[model samples]
Target: MDFVKKLPRTSSGHDTIWVIVDRLTKSAYFMPMREDYKMDMLAILYLNEIVARHGVPISIISDRDSRFTSRFLAVNARGPELVQETTEKISQIKDGLKAARDRQKSDADKRRKPLEFSVVIFSAALHGWYYMVFVTTVGEEYDKVFNHFGYVKCTT
Candidate 1:
């Protein structure tokens, strides 16, 4: 989560945008906020904008802005267990993202393979036609030259 400050004020004088992103889904929510809102107001906004919709997140990653550093926002938890749980969640998210990327790349490769093959075949045919034109124009011994190079007998 982060804040984008110093934006142009709206008609109601809101000048900050709360930028909340769900890391697992890469989804984002932008909420307009006033610059001078206190801890309580911020809490209410958080509850309404985020918690009310997504329930609760497993953990939050933030820039630790002054609003977040306030005592009211702090949560007490067992240190080792919190660390382990956070680590496991992060590892799973990473693995899922990697697998998604790999699948996307495989699909892209499948789509491109036929196009690449077509280009190769088209260029070969063009080259063969060009060679035939050159041989015919240069001399009457086209068959001898073609047979000597063994190009006419070549198969796909």
Candidate 2:
């Protein structure tokens, strides 16, 4: 599980795409840009805004856009192939995520039947058995912790 960020052009200007992912949990946020921003400004934005909130990630991956690689390039000479390769890599990541999510849901559904099994196995115990089964079978809702837009709303 790695974190990846992408800069996509939005209606406002160039927006930063922030992706935070764990094994089965994933969240994406689109952050709009301020005026006259540079690559250094972006680094600061990533460090202060994104990393500060999520803590340091294991790895950070991004496309070879000018905003990411201009400091390494010589004047106007930048690699177009790098951009193409990075774009393809991102697409593959998106597809993999979709598959992982679907599989997780399927497995959860399959495991849910153990609640019914507990009834037969623990027929002598009435009160505590069903309570334990109910708590164990229910997964935490991601929506309660994060919104569709990836903002962390404090429920407490």
For each candidate, how many residue pairs have backbone atoms clashing (under 3 Å)? 0, 0
User: Which number leads on TM-score?
Assistant: 1
Model 2: lDDT to the true structure: 0.55
Pairs that collide, model 2: none
**Residue pairs that clash (backbone atoms under 3 angstroms), model 1:** none
Give the 10-residue window scoring lowest on summed lDDT in candidate 1: 114-123
Model 1: runs farther than 4 Å from truth? 57-156
Candidates' C-alpha lDDT: 0.70, 0.55
- The alpha-carbon deviation from the true structure for residue 87 of candidate 1, after best TM-score superposition, in angstroms, is 24
- Candidate 2 global TM-score: 0.25
Residue-level lDDT of model 2, residues 1-156, one tens digit each, is 223335555677654443444442366554556445677987887778667887874644556544555455555355897788888999999999999999999999988655322211121223333222223334445345335544432332
Runs off by more than 4 Å, candidate 2? 1-71, 74-79, 113-156
